[model samples]
Target: MRLSLEQIIRYQTEGYLIVENVCSHAELQPVIEEIASEIDKRADRLFAEGKLAELYKDEPFERRYSLLHRQCPEIGRGFDIAGYLGDEIFKLLCNKNLIDLVECLLGSEISCNPIQHLRAKHPARGSADGSSAPDYFQNVPWHQDCAVTSEDSEASEIITFWMPLVDATAETGCMEVMPHVFKLGYLNHQAEGGTMIVPEKLPQVEPVLAECPKGSLVIMNKYTPHRGISNRSDIIRWSIDLRYHKTGANSGRSFQPSFPVRSSSDTGSVLRDPDVWRTLWREAANGAGRKIHRV
Candidate 1:
């Protein structure tokens, strides 16, 4: 929805803002059902191929991903936005409320960045202290969105909308961010352990936990340093982070596809068909591969 004056101020000043109830379960249910159907289809294939032991068809969506993961770590291979692109999924991308919130920060013209993700963080499988948890369950390293992009996109302004499909709690590995640091611009990041801010260069500010319920969104600017914690709870933490910038701006990943989803000045450039969106990625994939992140 259109952000309030105070909400805009908070995002501008703090580098991030936790917007609650920007969407309803009704709006997210379609995407959730699509995902569940995809899981069922994959499970059936694996079962017939003798790669999966049980279909687990009766399990609910929240528990199914982790269940399959425990049996086969590669259960979700290549399961990102491109892999899950469909009519329902495309409609969610053009969600009016989400676009409205985006417009408040990014103005009218907007292009959906290729730096999107569908995160199904598996539950921690170690001691309660979590010191021995696997890398899959570890907290994401502190890094800024801009630092991950190519040098050519260093000047472009991007915003991240981290939307969880279910309620997110601090214990369930909700995202956390360093506030009041977006103005500092890109910082030095190390190549080791994922491209992250250098330990010595990380800001000393207290990280704020972006705990919120389903249908809420955790908004952050391009330079905001944020990371998601491990899922200590039993269920998988399902979240999707979508990025957007002004149309025609450097999308950071020239090899992948970026779509014009909204525009005030050039309405005809905005893409609407789900089939076309899928085709764009298909064509990009068929071409030669290139690095998505600089690191």
Candidate 2:
């Protein structure tokens, strides 16, 4: 599952690469089922508490979240990798096929950064006046991965993987990236909606649409400028973002927990227990406060 030399070259030169069919549907079923089960658990409770209208039990996994959200927005909260740390997701973090590709570019040592997130970008209600959707559910503005991290990690080569649980198409609001922008060095960022790259500081270049399919991932360099557009389609656009950097490097999120996922030199450091992962997240949640991520 290691990437070819040419593919690695493209990733270095272009600052991004699309690797399709990295995992089969059978391999993805575990996470999908786990998420579906979570939805059922939450929906049932919300219904009992009179917060939700109906259970929407008949709806499919991809569509159920949207239905539940339409009734009550709380359904979308606290569902990230850090929120629950499910066994399946922790396993996915150490997925062999994924780590092989990561090892190809990052060598044998790899640490899973704590900036992971599962984005369920629901479709925009309508285009007229723009519906009242949360920032997480709305169109993501143009930005670079490096801008979200602290200045301490400005030199770390943090690799990002945006893997869709379902097919991500242009109509469904796939991510668009400015290729080769990494060569421009770090772009100036400001306190915009979400600490985005300054508009006047942007380079004159067109963006490449990353319409990835299920089981596929779009690999990106830390400085690659990218954004997610509005999901105009009928269904939700589901995707998870995972990051890895050289072991012992400052993981942008100093307050969050990072785990050694692959270590050829020291196998003992690689985290293999889901309980430990959950415990680490719980500890972080209790002690971590609102710290200035960017200077």
Candidate 3:
């Protein structure tokens, strides 16, 4: 989990680093199983409502959602699962390996940014020939994480970890990033299908596909310009995008609460109770509405 000097340097030089096997299957199983359970519940409900003919009970986690979406395209758009701030998810957020790698970059004091999401990118039937038929959510446009954040956090050094539950290949809409663009700082982004870097301002560098195996992580800075491609494969791409930054630093969006995950200086401040962590998100979810720049 602790990154080597070369890995740290690579992240600094290229704006991203793919850390293979940062976590083991044992460490990831709980989170994966929790997601699979949620999928099963949804599948049952859809089946009862006559939306899905078969539950695909024997299908694996990677294929279940895609199969469900294939049978009922109407269920695709609303399939994105939020409220993942459960106990299992919190355990993954505080994973020692992940935290150690993050500490190497952001120091010992770490705050878990609230702008995290578990993305289940279903298969797109459309051709990969630059077609517009792909669902907007399946194919994310080019954009920097910082661009989607509030303006006040422009200077914050937020480290993002993109970890896939299944093997993510180019065919499965693995992330692609423009090398060394983080050094250039935040770029102008506009809302297309999603918040994206302006077409004219996109980096000219050839994008590198971040193909990663299950339990691996693609770590990037807030300014890294990256996007997910359309999932042309048959299976759904299950990935979690989590963010962390130095404790007490701005979390981009002040409206959402960021909890201390690791704090050597103030050990008592570290969140140990999963219920408390879940409550933080529950309060935010129930609080007054604010316009958030969706990524």
Candidate ranking under lDDT, highest first, comes to 2, 1, 3
Better of 1 and 3 by lDDT: 1
Candidate 2 vs candidate 3: the lDDT winner is: 2
- Tens-place lDDT per residue, model 1, 1-295, is 6899999998999999999998899989998998888888777877778888977778788887777766675668878777868677788788889999999998999998888877887677662423233584567899998876788998788888989998888877898899998888988888798878999989899999889799899999988998878788767778888999888889887778889989888899999998998989888852246555556
Runs off by more than 4 Å, candidate 1: 126-133, 286-288
- RMSD of every prediction: 2.2, 2.2, 3.0
TM-score of 1: 0.94
Q: Write the per-residue lDDT of candidate 3 for residues 1-295, one digit (tens) a residue.
A: 5899999999999999999998899988988888788777777887889999988788888777666766776655434323545578888888889999999999999999877888887777663422223476477888888875778887789989999988999988899988898888878878865798889998789999999999999999888999898788767788998999898888887877788989889999999898887677667752246656643
Tens-place lDDT digits, model 2, residues 97-151:
9999999999899999988988888878773324445666677878888877878
| lDDT, candidate 2, at 176 | 94
Where does the lowest 10-residue lDDT sum fall in candidate 3?
125-134
If scored against the real structure, what TM-score would every candidate get?
0.94, 0.94, 0.91
Report the Cα lDDT for residue 202, model 1. Answer: 93
